[model samples]
Target: MAEPTQNDAHLLIVDDDERIRTLLQQFLTRNGFWTTAARDAAHARKLLAGLDFDLIVLDVMMPGDDGITFTKELRTHLQTPILLLTAKGESSDRISGLEAGADDYLPKPFEPKELLLRINAILRRVPQNDEIIEKPKVLHLGDIHYDIDRGEMWEGDNLIRLTATEVALMRIFSASPGEPVSRSKLVEDLGRDRGQAQERAIDVQITRLRRKIEADPKQPRYLQTVRGSGYMLAPD
Candidate 1:
């Protein structure tokens, strides 16, 4: 197949190395593609919240979360193509990427052209995916159902209203169910100014959210507090 149109596709280049990230961004941009960079997996998640990219060029080893773990978590919610760059050429490492649903893997020390070629190959094979872009919006918090897209909750036929803040919070928590998200991280992602007051406010928001989704607000079920960490949303 002919190479995908670089002009038409946007790619996110994720790597912790400042030099490689800058070089790749420059090279990819010079090659006629739109590019964005993220320092690591956490930064990538922040970028992913606000933008859509045709492909993610991820480095295998990154701070906070390794690419394989990131890929597995990402696959749960997104079908976007991910091409992993591994410094090690071990079979086990390559197999891990594939097992985590990576579209393809390229060992490091490879030419930039090869990376571009693999990216094109994957994009060419990716299907028209508007319908499958985001994972299923309706998630079960025990018996209660929360629709991430509609920002609405339902108990039987009754509609439960969610404030804008609550809706936004649900969207964040539901995206990574079973993962503990830190309070400060939550504050930043929600676009709130960071401070003790804001952190306390997030606690308040969590309490209110629990009241609606938890079987018992005081003794919560779905939204359990992760001690020494933060809150985690574990849906059934």
Candidate 2:
């Protein structure tokens, strides 16, 4: 394996189509990127286990463990930027992908040059250490504190346990303290397909999170309802 140049970003291409996978790997490699191709979710997992990647170019409609589900699961531990490939007319597909944590999307039958442009654009958006290192990222909700950089919740000296879904919610809410986050947006951010059931699920998660952070979950102080709006984190 050749040592990549400073600008050579290591990329993972997750697509079930053999031709697309090969073409992406070759094309990206030619464009000064280190590329690894995976035929499906399982193969992608195995590759991920052994190597760290800078970004992932994922296809939305795979046979088993589709892109939305896979992206939802991946965001739990990995924050590597993701760009999804979806078929045209998939407006809902694009929403769900973003909810599942994809950084960008490109409709299928897309030009290879366009994919390169989107990939570079997303990579550029990724925050470098120096860019964020100086800004204080600790978020306080009453006595509980969340370190956004570390994704760890702390209550004074002890650590608070959070499930994968809860962690996702925290990440979203903590990003915009005091700003209202609507329930519909919450459903998408949770990586679940849109429906009444998913919104209900978000409600349940919010209740549970309030229990952990709020002095009174029933009458929440830190996590407040905005009535016409949605939820807001008012950290003190």
Candidate 3:
């Protein structure tokens, strides 16, 4: 498959502020991306169910299911990259955004150019369909299986969905199945800024991923934590 370039990339812009949403849609559209605007999370969900988007620009403050909650819920089934916009500028707020599964956060009143740059950066981090050249290999985890070449997980004949971050982590761990990957290294590879908060975000993502890969997330048999090293994928 051909990789999507910025000129042809599709974007979903969700914001309660009509003026802001319209402006963003116009700005991004003029910049070559196909943009779709949604009034709120519910609208966004409806559009998402029927359309494929390269990335989502979501506003934090809304009437219902604010951005953080929406993002966390989306992570359960979607792997699309999400960039959050919020009025709050505190470091804690930024950390919360990341912890909620946002790929990047930009405070409100940010310059349009900066938003474009951040969006481009996040899109660049997405793995291209043709990038994987290794031989097809599958990792067995109890009844679950991860296909390295295809970047997919399966249980019996049914396919299991993985969020973007989880897919990235699986790729990293599959490269060295039994070796531990440091949280710092995972953060770096995940294209996130280095910080204690980012590391914690990785932990959060790992926990969510375990629920899918491990029979017992509380006592994981496949994804194990190393006391001093990091996390390891000890697949059978």
The model with the greatest lDDT is 3
Poorly placed runs, candidate 1 (over 4 Å): 1-7, 128-236
Error of 3 at 87 (Å): 5.0
lDDT of each: 0.78, 0.79, 0.84
Clashing pairs in 2: none
Estimated TM-score per prediction?
A: 0.53, 0.62, 0.82
| Candidate 2 weakest ten by summed lDDT | 125-134
Name the runs in model 3 displaced over 4 angstroms.
1-7, 72-77, 86-114
Model 2 ranges with Cα > 4 A deviation: 1-6, 132-137, 143-234
Q: C-alpha displacement of 132 in model 1, angstroms?
A: 18
Residue 182 miss distance in model 1 (angstroms): 48
- Report the C-alpha lDDT of model 1 over 1-236, residue by residue, as the tens digit: 33455446899999999999999999888777899999999999999999999889999888889998998888767767788898754656666776566656788888887777777765654434342435557888767898766656898887765443565678778779999999998877665457775576577768767877877899998988999799999888
State the local distance difference test value for candidate 3.
0.84
| Weakest ten-residue segment in model 3 by summed lDDT | 1-10
107: Cα error in model 2, Å = 1.1
